[model samples]
Target: MGAGFSRRAFLQAALPASSALAFFSTSFRRDSLISAATSTKPQKVIVVGAGLAGLIAAFELMQSGHDVTLLEARMRPGGRIHTMRDQFSDGLYAEAGAYDFTDAYVLLCQRCFLPSR
Candidate 1:
């Protein structure tokens, strides 16, 4: 353990970023809802894949005055953010693959990381 490497210190650093994510999420949702109510000029835009990146981009484009359509192949959005709600009797759920986000991961998400492209 080096400087500022304890669990408490790690959480102290992470809490603010988590709070920022929550705040940004709520603000974006509110803005999108308000845009739908106020906007008139609609533009056609097709976004394939309903992953986090895709969804965020669509929301931003819509807020920037563009009509957006999302197409997901897995019968639902969330790409790797898959949840299994039927696996337990107590209504507990499990997520696959998506876990433990760090600052670098958030930066990649913000940059719309697509390695193939």
Candidate 2:
């Protein structure tokens, strides 16, 4: 055997490629995989509050074949996104909360910094 050659080493390297080949050639169609997910039975889901997080959760649950009802105590859908037009001049309004969405905010969300238990 050569200085850098062994049967164990060759088998370890070839296993992953062969496994991938078998996976791709399976009977399941790759392109229609999304459409193949069977629609789940309709379930009743009540979401508390109409905040951004609550709205997102409700939307996702509805898409997965669940009947979602949003319950908001406030008069508006946005929880803390308050705008007062009376205090400002004519044709003017003030945003008391909720900053503008940006690309950096998305990049920040993509990163996971918290340690898992």
**lDDT of candidates 1 onward, in order:** 0.71, 0.66
Task: Tell me the lDDT of model 1 at 51.
Answer: 78
Those runs of model 1 whose alpha carbons end farther than 4 Å from true positions after fitting are 1-43, 85-92, 100-117
Please provide the root mean square deviation of candidate 2 (C-alpha atoms, Å): 19.3
TM-score of 1: 0.44
Where does candidate 2 have its weakest 10-residue lDDT segment?
108-117
Clashing pairs in 1: none
Error (Å) of candidate 2 at residue 81 is 1.1
Which predicted model would earn the best lDDT? 1
For model 2, the stretches where C-alpha displacement exceeds 4 angstroms are: 1-41, 100-117
Tens-digit per-residue lDDT, 1-117, candidate 2: 467988788889889997996578465553353243225567788998886556655765666677889999998987777888999899999887676643323433444343322
Best by TM-score: 2
Q: Tell me, what's the RMSD of every candidate?
A: 14.0, 19.3
